[model samples]
Target chain A: MDKPLNCTIKNPVNLTLGDIKVDMLCGCKVVDITFPNIMSPEVGEIRFKNFYVATLTVKAKYRTENTPRHTGDQPKWKTCLKRVKLMPDPHSEAGSHDYISLTSRQFRCELSNITGLRLILHQPSPVWREFKLEELRLFRSAGGPKTSPLPTWLLEEPKAKVQKKTVQRVASSTPKGGEGGVPDLDGLSANLQQLWALAEEVSTSQTSQSLGRFEVDGCYDINLLAYT
Target chain B: MAAERRKAIPSTSDDNKPLDSDKQFLERTNVNAVVRDVLGKIIANRPEDPVTFLADYFEALVEEQSSLVQRALRVITMTHHSRPVFEVNVRDSYNLLSKHKVNKKLKGVNGSVYTELLQALCRNLPSSVTIKLVQKLECFEHEAVPYDVFRSSIFACCVLREYAFIAEQLFASLDIQKIGKADKALCDAVMDQLKTALGSSRNDVRRIIESSYNLAPEGLHQALERALSREQTQGVCTSEHFITEACDSFLAKVKKLK
Candidate 1:
């Protein structure tokens, strides 16, 4: 028996409301999970060589407040997959564990084709309101006589794509007066100078309070935002 | 000099009156402060039975200050422990208020304090209590009560398996047209509950469905008929059962009325 291929989501994978960017009250959606060894051998084929079953064991700890105030100490877990088909494992009859086996071709195809896994937090018990992803392990086993260690090739972690920023350099030279360049003021006419002088005189006179002054009253003025 | 001296002397008239006495004057003068003070004390002390204490305090306030009472009630009911007491207090207050038409007096308060009380009471109250509240609520016209409040009360009754109460009190008495206009979700919820009740083999389902036929709006009757027919066609319903007979009789009655 080959030791199961295990993948761990980096700890504290906080589920968030995508638009508001706030922590989810009850559920999480894990997307783009790629298991290295389980890739289709052929480009479009849905079959995987020696694929049997994947056991996902999640050890989750919920937020303290998630437990109902009435129920003391005993925190009930009501977390479940929203879309994934999970069945009770017949092999492990002793312990209570959720299992999903790719025993059939359709199930294997579904598993291979899914883009993401969504987990929903159900009701009755409020204990599943918020939970921390403590440990997540996926164990893959092929039907065999002897157990072997999970292949190192399948354990290679996916690399995160880093964004590269490109810097733009400004042009080296400044243009002299020409098309799309600064206008030259040296060629001003006498009539234009007279008009400019008059405009400057009016601006100066306006700043000196040549306009009539109106009496300002403080009473009955309302600040709309003030409650009083 | 005399005017200045008179201004210098602080008015002791406000001090002479009992705190709750001259409620109208006090409310006009410092209603917010009084409300805050009362709320502060209630929150700080965390009484053994806050709902009753708050209700008593609210009653002391003049009717003009009913909003403050509503606020206090909202606060008390929001907590987990005070729910049972809140239900009892609400029932008493609703009865008293209904006798005097308090919801009408506080019409400016938006659906009145009765609506708020109903909404709060419906949140996880026992079906028995919910039925009583719904009956009391029926005193007001369908337009006066908020659709959500009415829906929640109905939903509570349904959840408690009091389908008969829903059929007789709500479905029969409510303005089906207004409910349809105001909140289609509520109408759908009612229909769903009715269907669920009708599908069951419980001894009461027959009685409940028959009563529903008597009180159900035309649209609801039609919906029920369609649902029953669908179930019948699928061979899921046996003719010997009460549901089939009830459906046939209801459809016949509806056709006769038309």
Candidate 2:
């Protein structure tokens, strides 16, 4: 979502990967998820601001972060990483391709209508790493494009600094667990470090309850692999 | 009439001597009547430690006078008035209560504890019971339930959030066919809550909406979809708006996910 997508995501799409165990949310506290989508159906109709959009196939992989311990007695957890992909339903949008290569490679949907688009955008797609503009190319769609050293989106990179934590627990209380203390960076992930900056902003918002936490352990792993 | 002691206790007067409202207790033949008596007492007594009194009240029941034990509980739980208070005071009593099954056979007799507990369960009421009421007010559909059961169902839904199996059991008890179609109130609640909490930024709105959309219906779901669409224009939701954004983002992600 930070960069321009090549295609339009006009409609809602349902694409799935593995072990997700999705269910149609049922009853009282169960939130409503569109039945078709919940059942892993192929069609989607997304609307924003009361405007109905097109339907497509949207595949997502659920991701999280927590460097799972490689061995036991260490008590580890898997930080699921997810990447989302958007494509025109091949059944609906494409035919047997004369160009084998285009057909073989998966499609990326670039939404032409950006009026009211919402992608959680926190995580990246499996195809995302491939989409990074590494060399910073400035070419137009048909190759008759203007050249520039920096792409249009570049403003200024912020100054980078290493921050330190003076985690002073209450003097009276002992650490909660057996491994009384954690290595400072053991649970920290790149995304969490970023959220830490957001946490600073939350403290200034004048709210009674602290909605955001300084806990970087879970978020880091999810964001690291997904948001990168 | 009877001051017969079941077990030895210090406050013999409160236990043995009939309360000023003894006439009402004598008239109580079923659980609802007992519930009315206990609720009236709690509302009137308004004791800081009603739970303790309730426990003492239940423990004081004798074999012949055992009706008092279940009767007092019936009064505490029915009408949804003092159940929480009762639960808090006799915190362990909830476990005991959930385990007890009310027998339906005893109705007109003096010791109709069975009929009493059943009536006190707040079931078969004509109006929509709260527990079932909320369940029936669906983004989808739910019904076939009662108030106390509905209240517990909501909590049950929340508690089983991490487990799929538990979620299934929670759904099974719902008044599914009775629940209506999508609701606009959900949309209003979500949008209003988000706007109040996170401001009008599109990204912030989306985060806010997503935060509550899993619990919304109809137009609010529409609003959330709108918020998600606005992300590109406003930029991804910033951390300052994380509260609204994180949840909206998660909900949108889960829905669009394959």
Candidate 3:
């Protein structure tokens, strides 16, 4: 398996902040839209034509392998994977209760196939074939996002989870550069209330992002063009 | 001189105040000396008294270690201003820069200073990996090897926000081998008379063991003989049932050996 690139697409790629798209707390994205037909076997020269964009995620995934045990390197004759409880929320969708320290990392995700591929990055770096991919789609356009650049504020620590009470109290006192900087408090308050008052649908259903479930639906074996 | 010192206690009467002041001065002097000595040792001997250093370190955070209640009082009352100036004489008569940084944030609330400091001291605790490495060191396996009180105090943290790993590392420091010993008979007697630890709160786990006299998994008795055979080979002569039923006894033997 090829090294799957850890991509970070501000999950809600274009969080519509009034008129412009503001990348939320989500990480950068490397997206490519293609016919899903071709698998780039060759890490080739970057020509101007084969450019595409795909949504990205900065998920923690792992690839691992076992090594030949040199009886000398390890302790006496003992071999055990130290186990620890799964952290944070036990029922979190992150999966795996307590992760065991084996010899490798672990986590997996998928990306969808769409046309009009572009790289929405934390920093504007030209997207090329540097990402080691097991299987990847090609793109036609590397047209960057329409947003003005990620304002310096979004890159900071997890924004304080402002509650209604907190919003009321801190609406003024909150440190300058509050999440997404100068977030429309009125808009935020409304979204927050809507999120809280599920009333009926709380038990049965929610949108994929709402439920914290995401998959970039990638389709394969369709004729796709490559844009460097 | 010894007799004079003993007799002095009775005649001193009002000297209690002065004696306490002198004792405080002496302890303060001793700390400066110990730290200078410890710093020298930390440089020369290299990390010998890290835990002792850690203990003494966290101890000073205690406004008063007279007892739990007094320490608790300090927790809520020890003001931020006090913590910075708390280690006044720590400056000592010697040493260039006071390299030791004080946590100006430590708020002392009267009696709870000890507890609060204990919590804050976790900030300085050895990493879990570092602690494990130390535990594995032959030096740490000795008869006088110190237990980490920092690890012990975390049990008080129930919100369980963080530090669970630190909690486990602290609890595992309880040496069963140190508590159980060769003189099983004598150890059992003392253990029987003793009560549970002052801080050991009653919880479901305690209730489970108390209700059934079963401390481990159910249906362990049937496998005791086979289990004991393996355990005995490892120098632990214990049936599953015997060990569970007599944990206090086991701990006593280990403690006695120490």
> Which one wins on lDDT?
1
Local error of candidate 1 at residue A140 (angstroms) = 54
Writing each residue's lDDT as its tens digit, candidate 1 over A141-166 gives 32331223443222221111001100
What lDDT tens digits, residue by residue, belong to model 3 across residues B1-258? 654565457545565554444445557667657656545633432334467654654575554535433333233222221233312211220111112122464322221332333343333333442232223221211122122221122212211212223222222221233443222332222123222221122353443233222111121121222233344333322222222323222122211110
Grade the docking of candidate 1.
Answer: incorrect
lDDT of 2 by residue, A76-165 (tens): 222111222222332232321211111101324332211222232111222221111011111112212213435422322111110111
Note the clash tally of each candidate.
4, 42, 59
Chain B alone, TM-score, model 2: 0.22
* Candidate 3 chain A, poorest ten consecutive residues by summed lDDT: A42-51
Output the worst ten-in-a-row residue range by lDDT, candidate 2 chain A: A157-166
Better of 2 and 3 by TM-score: 2
Q: What lDDT does candidate 2 reach at residue B65?
A: 56
- Indicate whether candidate 2 or candidate 3 has the larger DockQ: 2
TM-score of chain A of 1: 0.25
The CA lDDT at A8 in model 3 is 26
Mark the regions of model 3 whose C-alpha exceeds 4 Å error after superposition.
A5-13, A21-37, A40-228, B1-215, B219-258
